[model samples]
Target: MEFRLLGQFELRDGDRGHHLGGPMQRTLLAHLLLAGQAVRTTDDLTRRLWGTADSSTSTLQVHVLRLRRLLKATGCSATIETSPGGYRVNLGDDTADVTEFHRHIASARNTDDEVRELHALDAALDLWRGTPLTGVTADWPRFPEVRALTEARDEARTRRAELRMTLGRSPDLQDLRDLIAEHPEREHTRHLLMWALHRAGRRKEALATYEDAYRYSVGQLGLEPCRQLRELQHLVLSGG
Candidate 1:
């Protein structure tokens, strides 16, 4: 069973999916699953569920009980255990999509083989369906933790694009352009776009990209380009 919170909240066991009840239940499940073997304190969970720490702990227990009943009804192997301060969700052999995404990224980075790294990065980005925790709403999704997943997804995209260019694959230049459009200040990805442009024989445009970035930094931000960007521009200028 995979608890998918990558997009919509769904308990996917094979092709069949167990209905995860209402928003509160979905948010609670998202919290515990994201905790990933760590106990989420009762107080922390209450604040997430109700947006205030004043909610009754008994209410939380009711939701946990309902979740357990749902698990038993579906015969899922996942277990929720109560600890001294809070609750922990054990997924057993089953995994969550978020866990798989992180694992894929880690595997990619640890690999020296560029082709293998590209594939792993692809897999990691593919796990995202849409904005994460789309259905799991309330205070939980509003926090930086959920936002971090989206940021990680964005980085995975840029990394994959960089790796593809390194492997001599014809990168989607438009992807890099779109990436820069969204994150002009992201020097690493901008470097990637410059490399892709240089490789594609767009030497003038590549230099112009650096110029545009330079103007943005010096004029708007009153800062110079980083050492890496300057070196890249030097390499591009000498046709290296």
Candidate 2:
């Protein structure tokens, strides 16, 4: 069984496709796929399906049952196990698109393959079509996958910045400058911009950029600029 939540939500068990009919069904399936191999209680699923409001447990069970039947019909033999207090969709027989995506990214990072990493990052970024939970408000808060994806996107951006700087590519400075302007609170972006400026012989501008980054970090996040940035500032002053 293969599940795709990137680009579109789709499930394929063997050669047959599982067509989950309603928004609720999609949400349920999404939660299950994102949860990995963990057992999610009925109450947990119910809260994600229907917030602090009235909802029938039987109704949720009905949805789960229907989803199970749909998976079975699609040729997935792995069962959605129901225990006394909870249920878990066994992932041993299933593959998630998001999981595959992260795996590819991790591989790229490990091998230091900048070209492959950039391509995979772009593909992963494109996978987000809209707000994660779109029509499912109950599932909005405390969704770890949503946070994970956000962090992944940021990580991709940072990696791209590092690669461009290391390549001694000057034209890439404008893009990084724009990124810093847009995300003034991001010290990582500022650090890259500073490095780009210094490497391009714009020493005064680079120092000024560091000052700005320090001020922004202190004012907005109530934190000092990171050690790397501070060290870079000192190195620049000493004519490094």
Candidate 3:
């Protein structure tokens, strides 16, 4: 059984996809999975499911029971185990996409082989179908855990773009443009975009990109661009 949380919340059993339950149930399972082996207490689960005031202990128990039954019906080896504190879904050797993504990225960072690193990074980035934890509502995206995961995803993307540039591949200009539009405040991405443009023989546009980033940082952020970004600007200017 494979639990995929990097994209849509889905359970896969050897080529067949199993639906966990409705939106709420899917959100519940996501909360547990995001905990990643740490037991989420009843209080925490309740708040996550239906906020602090609206959630009932009995309601939570009912949902947990339903989720457990659904998992059982799928014939997966994984199970949601109840403990004194709360409940935990033990994956038990079955991998989650999020876990696999992190594992690949760690390998990429550790390996000295650029080819191996690129492959690992490619595998890591491929785990994301759309956004991290798509479809589920109920404040899951607002959770600190989800925020950290999103940050990791973004970092992986930036790393992959950097690696592709190093490998002399023509960078995905439109993808980089979209990323810049999404995260205008992220200077590293702007730096990568500038490099991509320059590598494509668009030095004039590359220098203009740096100027735009510099203005955005100084205007919106009330700060100067970071050292790396400044160095890149200088490199572009010096025809390096």
By TM-score, the candidates rank as 3, 1, 2
Expressed as tens digits, the lDDT of each residue in 161-225 for candidate 3 is 88888898866777777788878998889988988898787999998998998899999989998
> Of 2 and 3, which scores higher on lDDT?
3
Local lDDT at 217 for model 2: 85
lDDT of 1 by residue, 146-186 (tens): 87877888888888887787777877788788878878888
The best-first sequence of candidates by lDDT reads 1, 3, 2
For residues 92-193, what per-residue lDDT tens digits would candidate 2 score against the true structure? 656776777677567657766666666666566555554554543244437777778656756676776786566654535766776677567778788888
Off by over 4 Å in 2: 6-19, 52-56, 72-79, 90-94, 105-141, 163-184, 197-215, 218-240
Q: What TM-score would candidate 2 get against the native? A: 0.64
lDDT score of residue 221 within candidate 2: 89
lDDT, candidate 3, equals: 0.84
* TM-scores of all candidate predictions against the true structure: 0.84, 0.64, 0.86
Question: Candidate 2: which pairs clash?
Answer: none
- Residue 216 of model 3 has an lDDT of 94
Candidate 3 stretches greater than 4 Å from native: 53-55, 222-238
